[model samples]
Target: MSNESPLIQSMRTAVAAAPADVPLRLHLAELLLGEGLGEAAVAEAAVALQHAPGDAGARALMMRAMGLPTPADDKAEKAEKPEEPAAPGPSAGFDWAAAENEVAGAVPPRFVTPARAAGPGVGAPEAPLAADGSGDPGDATAWEVDTPGSVTLADVGGMQEIKERLEAAFLAPMRNPELGRLYGKSLRGGLLMYGPPGCGKTFIARAVAGELGASFMSVSINDVLDMWMGNSERNMHEVFETARRQAPCVLFLDEVDALGAKRSRMQHGGMRNTVNQLLTELDGVGGANEGVFVLAATNVPWDVDIALRRPGRLDRTLLVLPPDAPAREAILRYHLRDRPIESVDLGKLVKVTEDLSGADLAHVCESASERALLDSTRTGVVRMINMKDLLGAAKEVRPSTDPWFASARNVAMFANEGGMYDELLAYLKRKRKL
Candidate 1:
């Protein structure tokens, strides 16, 4: 359906095959700009710049795409000789700062300085900067921490068994410090929620944070890993330090498998060191992690490092499954709440979407609305979403959880070591997956 010429499409395919080829990518960007696709050209040029940050061709193309003057244009202007003896300002050596501002929209600056102005006072203090001319030291301005949200476990739709287990194994001790002290229960451990994708693991983590009246800071691999030597470990340590500073903070580690993958299987020494740093933080090496609560979620718990799950780490494991019947109905209702709908049979829809995850239920609602929109567009008559459209979408979209469970079936059957995957195995057996 694309109206692009065959040559452009072929170049795109070649660029995809060799994404690191900066020249080829620049050529594609030039072609896109010629076709009047300014936005698309900017995107291609930006990607080429990423591959080769110092490439002159990529920078020129990006400037052209953004309708800004390139370095060559600046050079030409300087060579023409000014009429009034070039002002006694900066030297004629390419004003890089001005050029950066010109293409600021297309390429963002790598670092930012706090913008401030001195007040008209005698003793006004100037803003501080780091030794390297960046922001102030110990400034965790990059990481975002959300205040305690209102989404408690009660707001969570269903999965009653999961709730009960969470309350007994995790929340009860933290909620009653006196009882925990009497019972010799240490409030120092973490919980690892493992399940198929899109099963609301991160949502449950946030809800737990809300229940504890704690701030939430979520960290993932991208937030921790750095290409520079020893920086990844430093980043990981900073994440925990920030959580400790904002005590009564829930440090939710999304996709923990990538951050703490099994060290034995890891091929990179940097990654292994990063995992070691994570272990050190969890153990509260330099400072006490008294008010910090750690909650991690992963689709593949088996891939996480063993050191991370040893006694005092993420010892407790919770299996999050797909939405049950009540959950499906709630999810359907929530998604349909704002949409124009007529006679949505929640009970029947729940029955049809038995094993669908929360995300799948959302997709069903979206697909049904899309169908109604398409019909209205074709017939030139507006219509509300009906049961027929909902049913048709449900029939068309197969359960995305199927493939996840298919792989989980083999793991549950063969790799339920230390009874870690007992909950998953039991669910698989009940579902006759084994």
Candidate 2:
């Protein structure tokens, strides 16, 4: 059967006219992925993938379009895309002029892998796919993902208090910047989300920007570091410079500790400076949008530099703890609301999910759905989750926090406050879990 569609033909024309520039090719591939045309997207990625065989960005785009789940095993990617080592000569002896000409004064670009964006619910850029599983230029290239501010506070589960506080700090000012000036402030705040991995910290970061109607720009730790030929450190600076220009913006830095860690702890002399460069940007530089809010997330907050946590810097740390019983119940309800669930005691299930995080809650729900579908064959109809299904599902899963509980508790106590939640200080005094 012919899998080629008309859209694929048009895509080829577009890609034919496409320039070989790295940035433009990336943007075009992203547009294709947004349209759900997988096969074609892979072909576009292959252009760069062929040239820069080791280029993380090119490979990530290709993998995404090809539905290549993960980076083609590191060794496999290298072996597949053979490289020709640079020739040795007078020019090869580390010529500064040659290096300068190669980069042409561009920011030392980092090869950003898409794994960073592969977290649950975060979609990659779009590419077109053919039925026969071939890479083609997409039939169509249109970006239709939920726009900025699409995720409201209501969409978020069980962070009412944090939402309320964040609204006062970020949303309120963003909504009324001029009015904010009347209050003798421009409404600039930095938020650091620390919690167990996969607990929607990154989602919350993106949602916050959308909720605030602020321009959202997400940067990774590796994006801030690259040993490329041009002005690498300056590239880090340019990223923020662009954000500053796009005021009323939210610059989200995920795994922030990777970039903002303490200089003294850094063994690399160059990164010690990179840390400084980042800190300077986080702080105000020439009155750029007091409306700017920097939201950063990290699983391990302890590794972050103390200076970055000072009152004037990335100080406002927000904890997105694992979903509690009520939150998990809510998370289950939120994710399962669209599906059919019969004979399930949500309240009872909530009680049993004492240790579940939001992400864990999602897995549980997915597990229930799969079980119902498989069980439906004999039952003669699609089934919904019940207590037995949920409980059984819960039993099969475990919290990531459990394995590190002992050491985590020790650090939590000595560093954050005697291993007890500050909010639950009074509760723990009467009945301590630690």
Candidate 3:
């Protein structure tokens, strides 16, 4: 008998009991490889590959056991191939010239060149403005404005305080034009929404746009950035121009920090110029943006340009925390609507999911459904999602918003200039999380 350790012997016994379990087989193969039993490891890996032919780990182990090079080694070898010229004639009974001409039309080129700006050579200076001041038509299609969204604040589940603040600071003013005009409110200022990721900032922006009965245009960092120099700034300007053309429009800039990162931290001058263009667009120079309502959302408001948050720019800031109890219940119900759920105490679920974001709530529901599915498959009988499954999922899913609050607490304590993070500070204090 072979003198194998008890652990390895037990693993071999367990793998023998579950021969179809590819993962267990792979584990045994790994143990064999670690023990210097290359032949045995290769045998086990070959069996695993028969069970799972596309398993990369099994293939790599097989290669290692057979004394062959690894994938990375093969890649490096191919990269180091010589670039010497080939002989003009065929060799070893291969008709190279005929084969090359036969497939020349069918074989596609290896790479395609990127589109360039309509200007001189790569390093030459180009005109900043077009003859008509509007950018080229090709650039205008970067973002699309939805035609008057149907989602109002009432459709939003919770966050009553956020809704009230929006009404006072933005919506109410826009609704009553006469009163706004009397108070010298230009209706062209900006509001910045800062929060953790996946907390429905974009959805809230759509609701605000719906409340105003205005076109909703969403612009993200990808829409404004380009590989070529000066194109990013022009793209930013074009987005604002599109919004201005469609008056009473809501221009929601998503991930505003990327679009307006701090100039001091930026290494590239093109990024700084993009921020400058954003500032100019927010300023609404020459009364060109009278009815354009600019709303921007960023997870890290502290990283945005100081100029972008000045009084005439994105002046008002709202801190969008995680969903409250009512919001959690609504989110859970929405996610579980299409699933076969039974006896789910949403009230209890909400209590456990405190500080969880909307996305987290959806994940909990998905996890519960998956648990039910696995149970059904094991028993060969269908089963509905239950409270036990839900509780189990909630326990497994750590709150996604915790990390965001941890970072925000420090910023709220020390770097809060002009009480910018006052709402965040108050929340943290109330929760005793500071």
Q: What is the C-alpha lDDT profile of model 3 across 172-286, one tens digit per residue?
A: 8888878889998786768999988878888788778879999888888899999999999999999999999898999989889999999999998989999999998888888
Which regions of candidate 3 deviate over 4 angstroms?
A: 1-141
Top candidate when judged by TM-score against the true structure: 3
lDDT of 2 by residue, 91-197 (tens): 54777867778875554321122245455767533211111101111111111122355555555656666677777755676677678788866578777777666
lDDT, candidate 3, at 200: 80
Q: Highest lDDT: which candidate?
A: 3
> Cα deviation in Å at residue 110, candidate 1?
51
Tell me the whole-model lDDT of each prediction, alpha carbons only. Answer: 0.79, 0.63, 0.80
RMSD of each: 17.0, 22.4, 20.2
Off by over 4 Å in 2: 1-147, 168-180, 229-232, 337-340, 373-385, 403-405, 416-431
**Candidates 1 and 3, the one with greater lDDT:** 3
Cα lDDT of candidate 2 equals 0.63
Which pairs clash in model 1? none
User: Candidate 1 — number of clashing residue pairs?
Assistant: 0
Q: Per-residue alpha-carbon lDDT of model 1 for 268-360, expressed as tens digits? A: 899899999999999986447877889999988878898899877898999999878766766776777678887666677889988887778
lDDT of 1 at 63: 70
| Backbone collision tally, model 3 | 0
Tell me which of candidates 1 and 2 scores higher on lDDT.
1
